[model samples]
Structures are given as structure tokens and as C-alpha cells.
Target: MPEVPRTADPFTAADLVLLNGTVRTMDRAGTTRTALAARGGRVLAVDDDAAVRGLIGPRTRVLDLQGRCAVPGFIETHNHPTFFGLTLAADVDAGSPPNATIADIVARVEQAAADAEPGTWVRGYRYDDTLLADDRHPTRADLDPVSRDRPVCLQHVSGHFCVLNTAGLRLLGIDRNTPDPVGGAIHRDAAGEPDGVLAETAAFAAHAAMPKPETADLAEAIGLAGDAYLAAGVTTVHDTGLGLVGGPAELDAYRLARRKGRLRNRVRAYLVQDLFPGLSGGELSPVEAGVAGLGDDLFRVAGVKLWADGSLQGLTGCVSEGYACAPDKNGLLIFPQDDLSRRVATLHEAGWQVAIHGNGDGAIQAILEAYAKLGLDPLEGDRRHRIEHCQMVSERQLDQMAAAGILASFFIKHVYYWGDRHRDRFLGPERARRIDPLASAVKHGVTFGLHSDTPVVPVPPLEGIWCAVRRTTRDGHELGPEQAVDVDTALRGYTSQAAHLGFEEREKGSLEPGKLADIAVLSADPGAVAPDAVRALQVDATVIGGEVVWGGAGLDAAPAAGPAAGGGDGR
Candidate 1:
């Protein structure tokens, strides 16, 4: 086992002590103890109840876990906090369970338009054309009925495509004469006119053109998102697309959120490459401008985010073979191979950890090729370059990633939400069955982490862990039992492995002396529960830096109140 740190004064009193519980110190040896102590926002010790009791002083806050289970708090590796927050605060929810058809979505938009002032853009999100009764993306004709005078845009659940009304097309100055961007498409009708569906860069351009939410509203949204994460026992989040909304000003919104006491979780932010001039045509990239590791622990600019391809479910991910449903149609790459390689090499050499989104096997291969062009041994350093959503990686790719030391952050929830479609329509049985392939990655000696990819999905780490372990689809069909991992491995994907992906292994990810006292108290030990019942285990309390941030009402320690509970530079 790695050496655990101890305080200089063994008699120093602890700020908090949790006793009579299954303390799973997710350490190198997987130590288990009945009690744990914390002081100065760091773990003091983990031992039997009697051994920890000595650290409890007169002012120590004690909580009796009553035999419940306590493990390290979850660390979400890839998510879009700014975009997710804005969606919750401003956008219309056009997801299924509420709107089953295209007409239903049209009606929802009509209602939203009626409620809003005239001429303002009406946006809807999380609409899945594949799941809709119409089985097609909404066109300008369908959305025009809502309001031809208003510009309306409906985002696909995949976030790779969107349907814009005629008014929106005109607002963005896109038409039949407009040529498709190098890495994106403006889907056209039989008449050679843009059909209002934009893919990849096209959709991204439209989103960038749309008006940004007010800074105050953005801060509140951040707070709301943080509250949700805290309730789910997530102590840290990797905002994979920083400056995604409102460009560089989005960083200011984050600072505002932190100042208002709304930003609670530790955020390791990745600058969206497209939004930065340095990554584009400018001379000084953000890294050169000293933006890397800019903030304190609460919010730090960690790396740069790039996209290799699009979403698989949306038929935009670059697959090695044609889609099972559309044999003639292979997805597109977001960047040319040479362009991607050059960009990656430039960023890697500039000291930026690059996390490229690659959902399909072809895209994964492209990313690997890009890494290879760097001509540096990945294993030689702690670069920790990552491939996000490596959903369709094969054994060969896993071996390459293992040899190259690239981390795979799998969006494991896809098995539960889209596994059936992937098997039946997207990739066919063989490929779909290997989607996420946690067991194969493990066998090939590749390190991996699990993510929800919120607001693509909710930030429930347990659901991701369950999906990884069970490999079951929404309808309870086992999509790939062979790829299923054990509970401990699944847990580590969300905890230890996730922390490592963000380069934060020493400060977080486990319960150990000298580590931050970030923990989640669960109703039951997930490892002890039946595999099928693990998802049912609730988070009873969440502690961040030795402070109870959510739940814990029954304990003597009151949960932190409002924005004051957030950590870091009193910005």
C-alpha cells in the first residue's frame, strides 16, 4: 500500500468524525475501517471506532453512520456545466415522456413562443428525432406553424444536430446558396435548399450566434446544477467545454457563481478550443496566456477540449463501418486527419492536456493516429491525454490506448439509454455489444473512467456504475454481459479512475489520511448489495472538505447553507 500521511501532532483534534459505518477507503489496498476522522479539510485517520474516537475533541462534529456505507465522493470526468445549467434555466425541455411526436414538439414550441415576447428566439432541447413517433427530425415546415415570425431552434438530444425554423435560418443567414462548412453539414431538401437541419459545426455555429443568458441567470443556473450534483454525492466535476456559452465571458459567469456561493463542487475546466483565438488563428493560446491552472482548487482551467467526431446515436459519429440502419451512410469527422493531428501536436507540445471527443471506432482510431504523430512516448509522462466517450473502441484500440497510456472516459449510461438502438440500428449486435467494453479495456490493461455526460444524461454516478456492472439496456435486456465489470471496478470508474483522468489522484478520489475529506454516505454498501439492487442505494449524505454539503439532517452537523458553502478564492 502507498504510504498514508499523518498530521504532525497526533493529539490534534479532528474537525469531524464519522463512526459506526463501513468506511471504504478506496486506497491502493482497498482498506476498510469502521470509523474516519478529518481535520482542516483533510483526512486525519481511518481506523476502528475506538482508534478514531480519540481524535474527537470538545468541538468535533460527530455523526453516527449507524452501519451505513461511506466511500469517496464521485468525480465526474466529462460534463458541460455551463451548457447544462443554461438549458435548465432557459431552454424548453422537448425530451420524450412528455412529447412523443414531432407535432407534440411543435405544440410545445408554439406554447413557448406564445408565452415569450415577439421576435425573441425560442429554443428547445433534448429532443430525440429517432425516438419520436414521426421518426424524423422536425423541418422548417413543422416548426413554422409554431410561429413563422419567430426564430425557433430545437436541439437534438445528441447535441450534434439541431432543427431550425425558417426564421432562424434567415437569422443565421443560412440558405440554399450557403455552402457546407468543412466539418459540418446543412442538410438540404430535394430542391437543394437547406432543410433547416444543421450538423456538427453548423449546429455549433448557430448556438454561438444565439443570445447568451444574463450573467446573474447563468450564476443561478450554476448553483442549481451544483445543488443537483451535491444531492447526487458528486464532489468534483470536469467541465469539459468551458467558454461554450458566451465565449470567454463564460469564465466570468463561473467566477460570479463562485462569488455568489452558488458554485459548490470543485470544477476542473477545459477550454473549448473553438472559442479561443489562441487555439484558432491567434499567436498566444490560453496556455501561453497563463490560463492553465489559473484558479484555486474550486475552479481551475485545466486543459483544452477538442472534438474528433459527433454522436453515434445521431448518426454523426465517424464509424469504421456504415451504420446498420443506413448502410450507405457513414458518419463524418469533425476535423480532417492532418488538421486534427497538427492541432493535437501543437496543444500537447504547449503543455495542454487535450481531451478529444471520439465516440466511434473510426474516430477513436483517428485520435490514436493524432497522438502517434506527436512522436512522443505517452507512457513517459503524466500527460494523461484523454479520449472522451470511447464507446465503440475495439480490443485492438484498447491495446493501443493501453500502450500509449491514453485514458478512456466512457459514457456508460448509453447502455441503459441507447443500447437497444445501438444494437438494433446504429452499430449492429457485434459492435453494440462491445460498446463501452469495460471488461475488455481492463483485460487489455487500459485505465478507464465512467461519466454521465450531463445534461446529455443526469449526473447520477450510481446509474453509470450500475450500467457498467449490469450492461443492461432500458428494457432490461442484457446487451453485453461479457463486457460487464464488477461493482468495485465500476465504483472506481466514477471515483478513483475519474480522479486520475482529471489529474487529481493525490488530492481526491479516495478516503485516506492527507486526502481531502470528500465522501458520500450511502444507504448501503454497493459492493455488499445485489448487483441488480446497487442502483437503488441512495446517497444519505455528501461531505466536501469535511463539511456536509447535502442531506445529513439527522446528524448534529447542519448542511452548509446557500452560496457561502462553496470553496476556493473568495471571488
Candidate 2:
């Protein structure tokens, strides 16, 4: 024969192939390619020419990217997917909607009452009293006009506070006599009467008191949130806590979603520390339980989440120095230093990852001190513990965290959402500039991830990257120029670094042979574009395990569910 040509073998060809795109591997080698081939939900090969062609056979689905930009799927290290879905289904937007004030909130509630069945609860969310005309939290009297017959619940955007009408209060059995729950207090009036404002665990209790949707409905809503994550170009998320979604039933909710084929993205969950309390009421609770290592690859409870302090924007963060607006208040600590350290040590010694919400320098320092006492050095053991919202920390604290081998995830969105307020009042300009110091963290050689902390902000990685890179406030002023990071570092915060946070680096977060094929296709190369236009870049496709999950030109797909039973990578 004069010539012979080889073709892809039918038996071993790839199931899917993507070609002609800029692929950022995000691996140790920092490989870049224009094509990829996948089989059995894992990457088979990454190449550009004959290598990719040989993987495509008669049964393969070959996608031509036509020169777009593709990177590891955006991984949200911290967020609230199920709760985001639940809020989308049940809560009204009291802030952004036509209702921006308590009066407007009343009007929206009245409208909800018009068609709602009697005795059903009506809920609204994102009600910012600071922005309201009255500049005060809504009280029961304000909600009574809407419907005294039906209970009304309004959640502050921070997810840390809630306002309820009188009926709602009665439903929760609160009449000022209900002393504050441990670690949670009810905001009462000067006369010692409940003012309809519930803080911390009290807020959680009141919100949990609402009638829950059926299991199937809740699962569906959770699925919808997964879909939302995919559409937003996020293929993995860390559901930071589960107290609001059915308590221990939260385990059931996520399990059911995965079993029903509703879960379309990877989830590593953390249960509330309350659910796994080492001690209760300053003493151990009679009933003992666990959530660590629960579920499989699709859903795994990897850690316990404890709140050391409240939100910085809410003026409840435990700061080393007092707030400028309220110099008398230094913010609330959810757990006393001793109790928090004990709980953290218990979990750390048990080999479970502990994720503590630490927003202020005080909280960060306390958490690091607790880690230091553990004595199980990272050089000797697996202590990839996390600090959520490590937004306010000193340089000394960063060095301590680095030495302790602690990982951090920052709520960088705050720079944009509440920067001016933080600068002008919360921390004042000097302390404000250090909030979420991306550049400083990078300089200190500490690994960290960026987050939205959803319900507080949307799950938009591009925006987060923008926030980290620009540090721009709402009014176009750069919050902290020195804190801003470059484009590549910002991208890593969402990709390779995020994988490290979830301990999934070996499997996802990179396009490499033998790894699950998870990739995000962008309309334009994020690095090649002007810095300010990064957020403006649109998602073209999101793939998980070689299958299209979102933005694939009308492709509706689910994530790759590996083995039914697999251990959590608290690696």
C-alpha cells in the first residue's frame, strides 16, 4: 500500500472531546493547551492536534470552542447553596424591590397576603434598616398592619439577624421572658420586651421555625441553587453551615438531593458547631452526635463550623479596637475565648477540619492562638483547618496563621458592598484599608480563597475576582490600592487555591490526565482583558467530568457523581 492512516479505536475512544480553545490547566506545570479528551468522566488526554483527534470516535461528542478561554471551573470555597435556593423560593426582596424601607416592606407583605392561604407564613429578605427611612430595625408594630393573622419573618441580608411580626414572635414562643439561647441573644426593648429583632442563634431559631417545604420540594430548591451555581460558572461550592436548612435534617436535605440526581455540583459541607457541641450551657450536652465524614463524593460533611464573632458590616465583629461609630461596643463573640478554644481543640484532636468564622483582628488572633495550642504541627499531621472571612487581620496574625498551617477564605465582596461604610465608620480609614488584604496575604506566603458568603452577596466569582483586583467601593473609589492583587493571583483564588481549600486539588481544579474533567469556558481570556472589565466577561460554558453542566449553548447537564460512597477529602 502507498499510504495508511490510523483512526480512533471504537472500543477505547473518548466519550467527549473539546478542541480549539485556550485552556489554562491550573496544574503544577501551569500547562496550557487548545484541546482535551475525556472518558469515564475523567480526563483522558490534553493536547491540540493528533492526540485529541485519536480520542474522538463515532460515539464521541466533539465540541469546537473556536478560540474562547477555558480554565478550571470556578470553585466557591465558601457559600450557602441550599439556603440560597431556599431564599430564592420563599423570601421577598425587601431591599432591592420596590420596597426599600419598612413601609415598603409592609406594602410588599400586604401584597403577599392578598393571595396567600390563611395561616401561612410570609417571609421577606435583604431588609437593611440602615438604609431604611427610619434608620431602625422594623418592629412588630410595623408588621402588624400587613397581617396580624399570618406570621411575617424578615431576614437581614447578613443572615445574622431577623425581624419578626408579633404573630411570628408568638410562634417562636418569645415574649421577652425567653432568656437568650446560649451563644444567641434576643434584642429587646429598653422596657425588657422583645423588640422583634433576633440576633445570632435566636435569629436562626426564628427562621427555622417557619414551616418547611416537603423533602422533595427542598431538594428541588437545592438543585435549583446548584443550577444557579453552574450558570454562574461555579462547579464546586463549600456549604459553610447548615443550621438554617433543617438542622440535622440538613444532612438529609443534601443527601436526598444527591440521591435524586438533583445535585449537579460538588459540595463539601460543614455542620454548625452547635450540632456537634463539645459542651452545652458551659457543660457537655447529654446527647452526643457527629457530622464529620458523612455522605460520599457528591456530598461530604468535612468539618464543623463555629462562629467566633459576627459580621463586620453588621457592626458586630469582635475587633481588637472598638468601632468608630460605637466606640463603647467592640462587637459580640459567639463563643467565649475559652469555650471556643476547647471546642476547636476537641475537633482538631479528633482529626476533623474546623472552619471558624473570624471577621475581626481580635477573632483571627484568638482562632490562631487556639490553633497554636493544638500542638499537632502541620509538618507532622493533617491540620488543614480553615478560617472563614479572615477579612480583618494584622500582619503578625497572618504570619501566625502561616506558621500554624491555617488556610483562610476571605469575604472580598465586602470591599465593594460595604467599603465606604467600613472606611468612614466601622473601622475608620486606617483599619479599613487592611480589610481583606489580598496583597498582604499573598506576600505573607499564606494560601487563601475568596468567597461571597452568599445571601450576603451573589455567587459571582468574576465579581469576587474584580473585587480582589480592584478593591473598588460602590462609588468608584478604590477602597485600598495597596490591598489589590494582580489578575493571575485573583484567578488562582477561585481556581487552584479554592481546590486546596476544599481538599479536592488531586481530582478537580486542574485539567490533567486521570483527573476529573472540570473546566470553565469564558467568552474572553480574563487575563488578556482590561483589569476593570474582568467582571464584564461572560461565561460561555462550564463542564464537570467532561460533561457540559451550564452555558454550553443549550446543553442541560448534571455533574459527574463518582462512587456512591467515598471519603471526604479533608486532605
Candidate 3:
């Protein structure tokens, strides 16, 4: 831990102050304070109401929190802002709540086609085959009725698979003779024809083939996503896929969003490795030309994002053992071991944080081997290289990760969204119970953070924290009681631990005197409430850089007299 820097003047006037609230500093000792003051967008002091009142000036805005609780703002370790925004703006919602069956999804697509201009593609997203009444993925024949003239593409909830209509497949130039790309598959019917189902790289290719959104539209979408994140109390986000939509154009959209004052949360971008071919070439890539911390506080190019496998729910993750639902079908790796090793070495040697998505134990092993092959040792320096998702990590893998100082960002929300199916259909009881394995990771001393993988799931940190602490399935059954972490640990996963994943722990995370004034004011303290009720806590206000960006309203005005004139019992 670093020392909190103080100003030369002991009694510097604060720009903002909050009195009569429970301020959870989230420091090393889990300290709690009654009142807090901020100056120059950084925390100035946090102490008893009377003590902090001394720093409040006439110009200082003082918010009476009553008996509410305030803690460090949530940090999202892994998310897809571009994809999430695009889906929200243009794609049809095929998720379970809206579409109960394949026919429902087809009807939605048919409606979209009817609404769209001729030759325009109709796209739908977040359809879960498992959750559908049909209990299977929709095929080309099912979607063909929506449009023989217009193309239709429906993406699985996992984002690793997609079902395309005949026109959609042809639009992407896929046919019976089109061989599957390395590390991806094109499902074929018994008659030796493409079945319109593409997985991994194949799905990625189809997405890339689609038309890119206009820059202004993309910027608006990003702004919408940012508003959603801020409403959910997220102050910082790690965009795990930067080039998901239009490569450099996506980057341009971010710049536009910032310029238009639409970007709300601080962003740490991880460029998709496949977008830059020069990474594997002799010369330096465009991203490599810049240093790791290339941008301002609002946005920065932090690392290179890679993938070792696909989603576990999509049944495309590379598992060591076959899925219980499909005995002969152990998922496939997205990259050959050697190729993955080369990519890791290339990005690692170039001084970029390499974050690889690995959802299965087999993929995790492959990633570990790649690191071992390069002889990369984090003990020498804090590389902080991370394994994203890490859903199916084993005890041995946890030990190795701890030894190597490799951090993990777990998609802990899976327990709440897909735990029952995972337990009974995917991994069987034993393996499914170990999904995420937060307790084992703590015991093995592996530094880890929790994530929603949002747009795959909703972007609610409280929900993620509740899931980590409860380990309960949607069916209201406990999937892994032994793996449940304490309330404090679960909160840390979204706060301090998440900041550590992005190498911004000292700057944000905790509400120290020198740290940025990024805090979330909740209706109640998560720790004070029952574990099951944690997710029910409402975010009353979100403060970023000493400014209330959401839900403040009349609270933004300064006190008429001074902090002493209006002070509560520091509840």
C-alpha cells in the first residue's frame, strides 16, 4: 500500500463534503468514517463529522446522506462496450424473457426484416438455446422464413455462436465448400451442407462481415452504454474488446464520445489482438508503437486482449473432460497451443498486459503453458498478466497462477444465471460446483476480481457481489456453498481487486485521502444487510472525480451556512 499524499496546508478548504453517512473507506483495515471531504477531485479527509466539518468552506457542496452508506465505486474488470452498445441500438432482443422459443425468435427476426429496408440485414442477439422452449439452436431453415431476400443473423447469448439465414450465410460468402477457419467450426448437416451455425472464429468472421455503424451512431451507443454503467454505479470499466465493431473506427468512436462529453466512466481499453496483424510480423504494430498507458485518465490503451477458448454455456470452451450433456464432445481451443504461445510472447515482450479469455480448464492449462514457455516471471516485477473469465479453473491451476502472480477476473455471475444447467448438463455436479471457486482461489492466494461480462449478463456489480457471496442458482439452489466468499471479500472483488486488475489500485479503488473521489452512495450498507438482500440495495448517487454524475439532483448545491450548521449524528 502507498502512503496517502497530503497538501501542505492542513486545513485546505474542501470543494465537496458529505455528512451524516457511513463512509466505508475500503482501506487495508476496512476502516469506516462518519464524514468525508474532497478537494481538486481527490479525497481530502475522512473522519468524524465535527473533524471533517472544519475543512468545509462556504463554496463547498455538502450532501446530507442521512443514514445512507457510501463505498468505493464499482470497477468492471471485463466488458464489451462497443458490442453492448451496438446490440442495444440496432440488434433485436432474442433473450429468454422476450422470446421463449425458436419460433418466437424467428418471429422477432421476421418483424425486424419487415421493418428494415430491402437488402438491409436483420440482427438479433442474446438468444440462449438452452433457455429456449425448443431446447436447441435455431437453424438456417428456421430463420429462412424470416427472409429469403433479406439476411438474418441471430447471436447466441454467449457471443461465441450464431445462426444465420441462407442469405446471411451467403452475405458472408460461406457455403459447403468453405472450410472452417483454424480454431473455429462451421456446423454441417447430414447432407454435407453448411447448417448456418458458426462457432468461435467463424462467428467472429460473420460479425466482422456486417456493416459498421456510423461513427456518430457508434458514439451515441457508447454514450448510452456509459449512462447504463454509471446508473449501475460503475466508475471504471475495462473494455476487454476494443476492435469488436470496426477496428480503428471503433477507436475513433471512443474519441468522438469523449469529445462530445458523452463518456461517463473511466475506460481501460484492451485491443483485440487479431485486429493488428503486425503483432506477429517483424515490425511493431500500431498499438505497440505507443506505450502501455497511452491515453488520459478517461481512456487508455492498457493491454492486448486474446482468447484461448469460447464460452462454457455455448459448449465451445475447451474442457479437459467432455461436457456431461455431450459425452464425445470436448470443446475446441480457439488457438493452437504454439500459436497462442507466440501471441502471448509477442504482446508480453512488447510491454503490454496480455489478458486471455479462458473459460475451461483445458484453455487455462494452455495459457499457463504459454506463459511457462516464455519463462515469464511476475516475481521479478508486477506483470499483472491476467486470465479473463477463468470459469473452470482447477485447484492445480489456481496454485500455478498464484505462483506466477497471474491474476484472474472471474465471471462470478454465471452461478446465478446458468448454474443449474451447468451443474446438471454441462460439467456434472462435481465440476460445476467448482465453477469460479472463489474460496479456493483465496486459499491458494491468487489475486482475483469479479466481473459480469455484461451484455452477456446485465451490468450490476451488486448482483455480481451477491452471486459471489451466495453461490445460488436461478432455481434457488446453492451450487457451491463451500466456494461462497464473505461480504467483504465479495465487495473487494468489485472494488480494490478489480482496480488491481487494471493496475489502477493506487489511483482509485479505496477512498483514501489521496485517491480519486469515486464513490457510490447506496441506500443501505451491503455488509449490514442480509447476504441475500445485497443486490436489492439501491444506488442513491454516484460521484466521480468529486462530481455527482448521476442521481444527485438538489444535493449538488452548497450548504446555506456551513457544514457545522447542518450536521447529523454521523449515522
Give the number of the best model, judged by TM-score.
3
On the 0 to 100 scale, the lDDT of residue 569 in model 3 is: 19
> Positional deviation of 6 in candidate 1, in angstroms?
22
C-alpha lDDT score of every prediction, in listed order: 0.85, 0.79, 0.86
Candidate 3 lDDT trough over 10 residues, lowest sum? 1-10
How well is each residue in 393-420 modelled by candidate 3, as lDDT tens digits? Answer: 9999999999899999999999999999
Give me candidate 2's TM-score against the actual structure.
0.92
Taking the tens digit of each residue's C-alpha lDDT, what string does model 1 give over 372-396?
8776566577788999999999889
Candidate 3: deviation at residue 291, Å? 4.2
Q: Residue 184, candidate 3: how far off, in angstroms?
A: 1.0
Ranking by lDDT: 3, 1, 2
Candidate order, TM-score descending: 3, 1, 2
Which residue ranges in model 2 land beyond 4 Å of their true spot? Answer: 1-6, 208-210, 277-291, 554-571
lDDT-wise, the better of 1 and 2 is 1
The clash count of every prediction, one per candidate, is 1, 1, 0
Q: Could you give the C-alpha RMSD of every candidate to the true structure, in order shown?
A: 4.8, 5.5, 4.4
lDDT-wise, the better of 2 and 3 is 3
